[model samples]
Target: MPRLVIVFDEFAEFKGRHPEESKRLIGIARQGRSLGVHLILATQNIEAAVDPEILQNSTFRICLRVGQAQDSLQMIGIPDAVNLARGRAYFRAQARQQFQGAYCGGPHGKRGESVSPRGIIWVRRDGARREINLPGWADGRGHGEPEPPQYTEAQAIVERIQQAARYLRIRRPALVWPDPLPPRLHLPEILARHFQGGWDGARWSVCRPLRAQARQIAEIQPLIGMCDDPARQQQVLLQLDPERGGHNLLMFGSAGTGKSTLLRTLVSAIAHTRSPDSAHIYVLDFGGSSALKPLESFPHVGAVVTRFEDERVVRLIRFIQDEVSRRDALLRREAVDNYRDLNARRAPSERLPAIFLIIDGFGEFKRLAPAELVRSVGALLGGGVAVGLHVIVSANLQADVPNAIFANIGLRLTFSQADQSEYFRIVGRPSEARLRQDIESPPPPGRGLLRGTPPLEFQAALPSRGDSDEEQATQLSLAAQAMSAAWKGPRPPKIRALPFLVTPTAMVEAAQSVAQTDRADLLVPLGLDFDTLTPLAVDLAEDGPGFLVAGTGPQSGKTTLLRTWVLGLGAQPSHDRLHFLFLDFHTRTLAAFRRLPHQNAYVGSAAGLDKALAALDEEVARRKAQLESMYEAADGDFDSGQVIRGWPHIMVVV
Candidate 1:
C-alpha cells in the first residue's frame, strides 16, 4: 500500500559507517516506485550523504529544524527551513505546505481522562478493544493499529505486481517455417495444420507434398468476384499495382450482360476495401444509370457525372488532364518515381490520392463526347497510371471501345459477346461457339470470363441498392452530411460560378444611365463579354479601332448590338455633342431609332450610302477649317479643349 512507510532514522550514520549500504539504498530508491516500497530517510548531513539521483526522483521532501541556513537551502531550496520550530516541518511534494504536528497526549495523561489529538475525550470506536502497547504515558489505553486494508481481486493483483522486485520480461523470436517433405511421407494433418484448408484447399493428384504445401495468403487487391477454376479456387481482383502493369481496365460485352452492374460492384468494393486516402472514385454514368448514384455519398468518391453532354464532359476531362500535368510536374520537381512515392513524401494537404475514373457505356460516351475528351482519356490511360490514375471503361460492343486504347488496358473482362470476332479481339483467342450448344439459355448477369494465361470464369457481385430513387437520394444525402461532418482535412476548392448572363436590354439600360452623365464619352456598350460578364465597352476615341460584330448567322445579336449603341448615344442630353450616322444594308434593323432626333442621316442601298459618305466627308473638311481658324486666333490647340460648335463626334454604323 502507498500509505505504508519504511523509515530510516539515521541514514547518514549508517552510510558513513558502511558505504555499500548507501549504494544499496540508492538502487532501491530508483526501482522502488514500480514496487510498493516507500522510503522516508531522515539525516542531519543531507548534502554530504544523499545521492543527487535519489534526491531528483524523491516525490516528498521535509525540512525540519535544520541547524544552518545553507543546509536548509540545499535541502529544500529555501532558507526558511532553518527558521522551522521544534517538531514543525515544511513539506514539499506535488505542492508545498507548512505542517505542525497535533499533540497526541501529554506525558502524564491517562487514557479516558486525556484529550485526543482532535481535542475529543478519548473513547474507543471498536466495541472490542485489546490492550495494545503504546508509549508509557498511555499504557492503560486500548490503542490498536488500523487493520490492514482488505483488497479486492483487481487491487490484490496490482499489489502483488507492485511488491515484486523485477518481472520476467519475455521476448519471443520470429518463427521460421521448415521445408515440406515429398509425397513419400504423405501426411494430411501437416497440410491441414499449415493451410487450415477452406479457400486454400486444392487436390494434389500426383504431386510431391514438398511442392504442394498449402499456404493461406489473402488477396492484396479487393476481390471483384470468385474465379471458377476447377482445380483451385481463386478470386478475381482489380489491382492498380505498377508491377502488375498499369491500372487501366476495359470491359466489353453485349446488352444485359451486367457490364454496368460490374462497374457498380467494382466501385462498391473500392469504397469498402480502400479508405478515402487510398482511392478517389469519379463515376461517369454515360448511360444514365442510377447504380452509380449511391456512390456520390461515399467520402472517397469525388463526383458522379450522370449528364452525357459533350461540353460538360470536355470540361471535366480537361480538368483531369490539367491535374495530371500538375502531379507530373510535382513528381519531377520532387524526383519521385511514382505517385505512391510522392504522396508518401509530400505533406498531408499536398498528398494526392489514386484517382479511379469509372466510365460506363463507352458506346454512348463516344457518340456524345468531343474529340478533346477522347484524347484526354487516351492520355490518362497511357500515362496517368504512373501518377496514380486508374480507368475502368465498360462498353456494350467491342468495336465501340477504341482499338488504340487496348494497348494501355491491363485487364479485359468480357461477358456474353455474341460476335466471335468481338470475343477474339478482346480475349485474343478464337471463340468456341459450338461448345456453348450444351447451354439452352443465355448466361446469367455478372457471369463473365477474365482473360489470362488460362482464361478463368467468374461471377461479379453487385452492390445492394435502395428500392426507390427517393430513398436512395435521401440515404445518399444523409450519408454525405455525416461524412462532411466527420472530415477534418483542408476544405475542397470552392466551385466558381459560371459568368452571370447579361441580357441586351440590361446592357442598354446601363448605357442609358451612363449617357445621362457627362463622363460617358464615346461609350458604345456591347453586351457582357463571354469570359468575364463585365460590360464590354469600346471608347472610340480612347480605345483604338471601331466595333466589328460578326457571327455565323442572322439574328445572332449583331443587329441588337448596333441598336443599343445608337439608342445610348441618341439618349445623351447634349444632342450636338455626339452625332450618329446609321447605315444598314437591311434597312429594317435600325427601325427602332429612325424617329430619334440624334440621327445625322439614315441611309439604305449603295446610292444612299454614297450620299451619306459624301455628306460626312464634307462635314469633316468643314470642321477641320473651323478648328484651324480657332487655333490661329487663340494661339492654342482648340481640338484638345471642350466641344467646339458644329464639330460633333460622328458614330457611323453599317
Candidate 2:
C-alpha cells in the first residue's frame, strides 16, 4: 500500500465535534491500504484531553505551525502554532520540511504581499519575485454592450483580487518569474540547487549545480528503493508541459519513487513566477500542512480561502456554481455567451481572472463529507472550465484520486509505483511509474511522474531535504520509533477519563438553538443526536480508533452537542481534560467555540479537516479503552472520575 501524508494540523481540536464523520473517514482510511487511501491528522491537543476510545489505535502526533502557549498546547503538546508567524507550518512527519516563511507565501496585498494563516506556497528557485504588466482579459462583455459584469458584493472581493494580480505583475518580467504555477508545476534543473542535500553523510543543496540525477546515493538512504539519480529525475521533468496538457493531473507512485521531490520542484518553480491573467492559480487545500504555503505570494491568488470540511468544499463548489452564473450574466450583459465575449470585455478592471484551483489529497475531503463524491468530481470535470475553476487533485490511492479527476482531465502523470493497477487507474493505461523498470526501485526522495505539454518521464531531486522529504516521511509506518517521538517541549501529561453528558433534551435544545446560533460547540450536534452519539463516546474512551458520522442530515446540532461535551469535560479542569478539542470544520463553529470559555482550542476549517476522520478514530480508541476498562459489561454512570473500568475518555460526533 502506498503510504499517504495525511495532514491533521487541527485534528485534535475538531475530532470530537463530528464523531460519526470522523469514524467513517477512519474506517475508509483503515481500509485505505487495500483501497489505496492514507489517513493522517494532528493529535497534539487531544492526546491526553480525550478518552482512549476516540483514538483506540492511534498513537502519533505531528506538530508544525503551532500557535501561542494555549495554541501550542493543542499542537506538538507545546502550544506552537501561536508563537510562529504566519509562515510557519508543522507536521508529524519530522523527516519532512518544518519551517515557515520558507514555504508559506505572503498574501497578495495592495503593497506587496503577506503570509496567509493556512496553505503552503512554493518558492521560486529563481530568487526574488519579478513583476510583469500584461494585457488583461475581457470580462465576457462586448465594449458596445450597455451592461457590464456585476461588481456584486460577493464578486467585489474577487474583483479586487483580480485587480491585485494585474497590478502586481504590471512591472515584472513575463516568465521573468513563473507562470502555470498551479495544477502541478515543475522546476527545471536551474532551481533545485538552492537547498542542501544529505543522507547519512552525503548531502547537497541547490547552490551547487546538480548533475543530471547524480548516478549514486551520497549521504542519506532513508527509505528503501529510493532513487537519487538527478538525471532520471530530470528526464521526468522533460515530460511536463506546465504551459499545457492536464491542468489537473495525477502522479501515482509507491514510496521513495521521487513523487514528492517532483511535486516540491513543481511548487518551487511556480513561486518565482506569476500568471499573466486571471484564473491563474488557487488551491483548495485538504492536507493541513504548509507545503503549498508559498503559493500565497504568487501573483495568481488574490486571496487565500482555507476550507477544512466537505461542507466548506461544497460551499466553494457552490460559490463556483454562482460564479458560473455570474459569468453567464456578464455574457448576457455584453450580448456574448462564450470566452470570445469575455475576451471582448478584457480591460484592466473589466475581466475576471482565470483561476487554477489546486487541491491535494482529493480523498480526504470525501472521507467524511456529506457531498456526493461523484457530483463534486463532475463539477470539476464538466463545468469547472466555464467558471474559471480548475482542479488538481492528489490522493494516496488511485481510487481516492476519483474518476472525475481522470475522466475530464486532459493531462496525466504517475510517480514510481510497482502496482500497475494503481497507475492504470490514474492515467487510463498501465502507468509508466508502475512500469518504470529503468529507474532504481527506490527512486530517490523527490523522484516521480509529471505530465504536461512536453510530458516528463524522470524524477526530481532537491539538493537539501525538500518538501518531498517531509511528504515521504509521512508514509513511514507509525510503528517506527521516530514516527511518534516526544517533542522538544515538556513531557505530555497523562490522559484522564471524560464522561458523556449530552441528554435527549440537550440534543433538542441544541437543535432548537440552531435557529439562533449554529449550535457549534455542544455535543449531539445542533442537528444530529441519537443513542450512538453519546453511548459511543463513552464506549470508545480507551483508544479504539473509532470514527463517527453525523449521518445524512445536516449535522445541525452536532457542532453544538460537541461543544457541550467539550465544555462538560473541560469543567473538570486539568491538562488531561485540556487534551481533547473540537477540530472546527470550515465553518463558523470555531468562532463560536472561541467565544465560549473552556475550549481547549479552536480549529476552524483551517487545518486537518481533510482527514478529520482519522482524528475521530483516535478519539474513538480512547473512548473504547475507557469503556473496556469498566466492568466486563455495561457500567452505570460513566463520568470523569468514575471509570467503568478505569480509563480516560471524551465523546465526539458530527
Candidate 3:
C-alpha cells in the first residue's frame, strides 16, 4: 500500500473546536509512523497546547520565524533563532543545522524550479556551459529591448484569472469577488490550464429532492436549492425579511422551463418547514396546467383555486381582501404588528397563519380578471410583507405581469426567456448563458437564475409522485372519481354563500307570490334588474300599447328574461286571463314557449307571421263592433265607461 502523509494547518485553532478529534489525531500521530503513514502538522504554537502526545511522537523539528527565544530553544536547541532574517531557518533531528532557504518562485513557493542557496551555472546536454547574459546585452542587438519583459509566476496566475473572467462572462452575469482573493484561487500552472477548457464549473448541480437533501444537513430554514458558488458551497435560503433579501417572489420563464415546478418546490419547502397552523398556502393555478395539483391535498393548503374563469378569479380576490381585513382587525385587537407577533401572544384559535399566495400563470388572469383584482394584488404586494402575507407568481414572461405587481417583488427567479430583450428585462442586463446552448442541451428542467446580492444558477427540485404505480395515478384517479361523485350526493348548503352570484333557481324561489292584476291588465315579471338586483315587474294593458325588448348578445339574459316573463304570467290567476304570443323570427328564440297554455299565437316563419297578424286584425274589429253595440245600448252617451264591462281583454303579441 502507498504511504499517506496528512498535513494539518493551524492545528491549535482546530483543536479548540474539536477536542475529541484532536485526541484522535494524537493517537494517529503516535502509531502512523509504523504503518507507512505520517502527520505534518503546522501551527503558531506547539502541538502540546492541543495534546502532548502529538509533540512526543513527532520525529523532527524545524524552527522558522520564531517570535520567542524559548520556542526556538525547544525546537532547534538555539537562542539566536528569533533574530533570524527571512528565507532562513534551523532544522534539528539529532544535530541542529542552520540554513538559508532559497526563493523558488510563485506566491506560495509551490511552482517553478528549486535553486541552491547560491546561484549555479547550468551545463547543456552537448557538454557546453550555458552562461547568463547581463542586463545591458541581449541577442547581440544594439537596441537591447530585453525580450519584452516576462511576467513573474504570480503575475501570470493573475493574468489567467483576468482572462478567465472575460471568457466566463454570461449575458446576465453576476460577478462576486471575495473581499480577499483566496489562496486557492492563486492557481498553479496545471489548474490555470484547466480554466482554459471553458465551463467555469460555477453552477450548482440540480437538487433531485429538496426535502431529503435539506433534512440530511439538518437545515431548518426554507432552502430552495444549493448555490453554484463552488467556493462558498452554500444552500440558497429564502429570506423572509428585507435584511437578507425579500419575501415576495416574481418568476419569469418561457413555456416548459419548469417555472411551475420551481414554484411547487419552493412552496413545498415552506410547507415542510412550517406547521399547518403557522402557515397556510393559497394556490391560484389558473387553468390547472401543471403538477401543482398535488399541493392541494397538503393540509397546509388553505385553498386551491383552479379553473380559469372570471367568477372564480373574482371570488378569490374578494376572499383575499376579506382575509386581509380580518387579519388587520385581529392584529389591532391583540396589539401586535403582524401575524407572527399575534400568534406569539394570542390563543391558537385566535392566531392567524402566514398566507402564501402562489399564482402559477397570469395570462388567464390578465385576460379574464377585472381591474379590481390587479389592484388588490398590487395592494397585497406593497403592504403584505410585514403582515406575514407573501405572493409568488410565475409568468411565461415578465411582460405578462403588470408593472405595479412586478415592482413590489423582492426576489426574482428567471429561466430561459424567448429572446435577448426578454433576458435583458429579467436580469436587467445581457447574458451569453443560453438555456438552449446549455451543456445539458435544452437545459435540464427546472434550471433557472435566482437574483440576490450575487445571483445564483439553481436547479429546482421536483417531489416524487411516491414510489408505486398507485401513487403515480393518484391525481388522475381522484379527478376521474370526482366527476362521477359530484352529482351522486347532494351538497349541503354553504353556511355563508357569496352574495355576488345568486343561482337562477334561488332567484326564482325568492320572488314574492304573483300579484293579482285587473281583468284587462298584464303583470309580467322579468328577472331582477341588472343594476339594482331587485325584482322587476312590467305592467301592460292588452288593449293597445305594446313593449319592445332589446339585448346586446347571447349572455345579455334575453332568453332568461323571455322565459321568466312567459312563465310568470302563465302561473298567475289563469291562462284565460292573460294570453301570450311568441314570434320566433330567429327559429328557436320562442321555441321553449310552444307548449305554454297561455299562448294565443306562436308564429315562426313569414307565413305564420302573416296568418297571426290577420287573425289579430279580425279580432280587433270584432271587439270594436261589440263595444259600439254596448255603447249604443247604454243610451248612445259619450260616457261609455260601462259599455265594455263584460268584454274580454284581447292580448295580441305578434
Candidate 4:
C-alpha cells in the first residue's frame, strides 16, 4: 500500500477553528509512523501554542524565519532560525542544519557582469591584472560585481523529477484530488476512443467484437459514461455490468437535467455495439416532448411510443409483458436457466435479442397508467432481468417512484436534484466532505452521481456532436437514418398494428384466399389481428349466427367494419347462396352493398322498411314450411346432420 501524508499549512488557525480535528491530528502523529502515515503541520509564530503531543511524536521539524529567538527555540530548539534570511530555514532532526529552500515562483537568468568606467578587469594565471576595454562593459565601476548564478524554479525542477520518475518506472504518491469532469462529452468521441476502426463511408467497419457478444459475462459490460473517482485519482469508463450490476436502472433528476439525453446516448451506444439481431430498444416517452422520437429510425429500435399515443402506450406495455412471457416459455422449453445460458447454447442466428424497455417520465406514467399496468411494470423489473429484459425508468422526483419498483433496480443515477435532501435520498447519504463539495458546487446538466461499490460521479456523453437540442435531435435522426439504411442484418420484429385504411379489393382478396384454404360455414375477414399481424376473420356460422356491429361516436369504424364484412362475404364462392338485406337508415353508408347479387332487398324509406321486414317474415315462414314438409316426407325422422341445401343464409346490415 502507498504511504499516506496529511499536510496542514496553517496549523494554528485550523486548531483554533477545529479543536477536535487538532486532537485527531495529534493521535495520527503518535501512531502514523508505524502505520506509514505522516503529518506535516506548519505555523509561523505560534510554535508555543502547538500541542505538546504533536511536538513529541514529530520525527523531524523545520523552522523558517521566526518573529523571535524564543519562537525559534520553541519550534526547533534553536535560535538559529531568527537570524535566518528569506528562503533560508533550519532543519532539526538528530542535529540542526541550515538550508536554503528553492524558490517556486519563476525562473531567473544569470546577471550581466558590471564593468569599470575604463573596462572589465581580468586576473591572469601569471598574477598580472589586465584591463580589457569592452564597449558594453566600459561604464564606470571596476570589473564590477560578479554575475549572479542562474536559478531554476521549483515547479520546473519538480516536473523534471516527474519525468525522470516515469522513465525509471517509479510510482508516485496518489493525487489528493482528481481532475474535474469535462462539461460535455460527445458520443462520437467516446465511441471512437473505445471501439476500433472508423467509418468506411457511412458504415462503421468495426475491428473489435461487441461487448454484448463477449464470451465472458464480466467482459460483457457496456460503457455508459465516464466515472470520476476523486479518491483514487481515476477517470474510468463507467460500464453497466449485467452480471454484477442488476439489469434494471432508475434515474432521478429535475426537468432538462439530461435524463432523456442520457437515455438517448445509451441507445446509441447499444446500437453501435450490438447488431439488431443481438439487441432491441423500445421507448415509452411519457415526457411528452418526443425526446426519443428520433431513435425510431434505428433498425435496433422496435418501437418509440409518445404520450400522445394513448393506445400505443398501452400496446407497448403489453408488448413488453408478452415478451417476458415468451422468453419465460422459451427458456423453460430449452431447459436454460437464463437468457445468457440460452444464448450460449443456441446459435447466434437462433438467439433471442435482448430487449431494453426505457420508460421516460415514469412519474407521469405511473400517475396516468392503471394500477395493474404499474404492477405489471414492477413485476417486469423483478424477474425480467433473467430473460434479457432490462427496464430503465426515469422520473423527475423520488416520490413519483414506488419503493417496490425502486428496490428492484440495481443501477441508479442521480442528476442535479432540487435539493441536497433529494440527492441524498436517491443515492444514500454521502460523506461530509462530499456533501460540502457537491453542495457548494452543484453539478450541471449531464453530470450525475452513479451508485456503485463506491459511489462515482460521471458525465454522460451527448448523443450528438451538437450542443443545442434541435441540432442534437437532427443529428441523431440523420445518424439513425444512416444506420438503418446501411444495416444488412435482420431488424427487430415490428409491433403489429391494424392499418388505418384497407381497400375493399384487398379485403376481397384476403377473404378469397382464406376461403380456398379452409372452408368455414361463413367466414368474413374483419381486419388484421393486433398480436400476430395475421389476417383476422370471423367465422359467422361458428362464433355467431347473430352479430351486431356497434361503436361510439361518428366514423368510429362501425360503417367501415360492416362494409368490410359485406365485401368479404361477397368475395366467397358461397355468395350466390347467401342473401343480404340492407336497412340503410343513412342511405349513403350502405348504398354500395345493394348492387350485390346476394342482396334480397334494399330499403331506405320508412314505408319500404316495413315492407322489407314483412317480406323477410314471409320468406322465413316459407322456409319453415319447406323444412316441415321435408320432415313429414321422411316419416318425421329428418336427418339432423344433413345440410338443407335449398335454404340460403340471410345476412342483414343496419
Measured by lDDT, the strongest candidate is 4
Q: Over the stretch 535-620, how does candidate 4's per-residue lDDT look in tens digits?
A: 77887555666888778988788887887787777866666668889888664688877778665678887778888899989988
Q: Tens digit of lDDT per residue, candidate 3, span 1-654?
A: 657677888877667656787789778767777888888878887534524465578777667777888777666667878999987987766677676765646443333433222223465434477765432233311132222222354553343344434445524234343232111111112122221221122211222332344233211334344335434744343334443455777888887776775666665555444445556677778635745766665556655666544455566666677678777887787687766766677686566667778788886677667777877888888667667777888888778888898877867878776564675566565234343354336555556666643556655544323344355346323432343233232221111223555455754554454454564235655555543345566765433366656788768766766666666656666666556667777646777677877646777777788888788789879878877776677764565544454444545443
Candidate 1 residue-wise lDDT, 75-191, digit = tens: 677888888888898877765677775443334333224323211233233324445322321322222322123234344234233333122232333323222212111112322
Q: Model 2, range 1-654, lDDT digits (tens) per residue?
A: 334545455664556555666667667766664665566664556453344443443444444554346555544454555655565665432333345434313333332222122222344433345543222323321233322244333453354345545545544222322221122322322333322331111221223224544443221111111122232332122322323453455555554454434443443333222122323455556555535544444333433334344444554555555666677677677776464347656774455654455565556656745556446656655664544444656656776655655666766656655665655455445334335443445443444444432333444434233245454333221211221231122221111122245465754554444332221222223223231222222213333347553645675566555565544444433324334455656556645545444424445674656565566677678776766676456567546446432333343333
Span of 10 residues, lowest total lDDT, candidate 3: 181-190
Candidate 1 vs candidate 4: which has greater TM-score? 4
RMSD of 3: 20.9
Off by over 4 Å in 2: 1-244, 255-271, 275-281, 288-290, 293-311, 335-341, 428-440, 450-456, 460-654
Residue 456's lDDT in candidate 3: 62
TM-score of each: 0.46, 0.34, 0.42, 0.76
Runs off by more than 4 Å, candidate 3: 1-223, 237-243, 287-294, 428-440, 465-654
Error of 4 at 645 (Å): 6.3
Q: Which scores better on TM-score, 1 or 2?
A: 1
User: Which candidate should be chosen as best, given TM-score against the real structure?
Assistant: 4
Clashes (backbone N, CA, C under 3 Å), per candidate, total 0, 204, 6, 4
Better of 3 and 4 by TM-score: 4
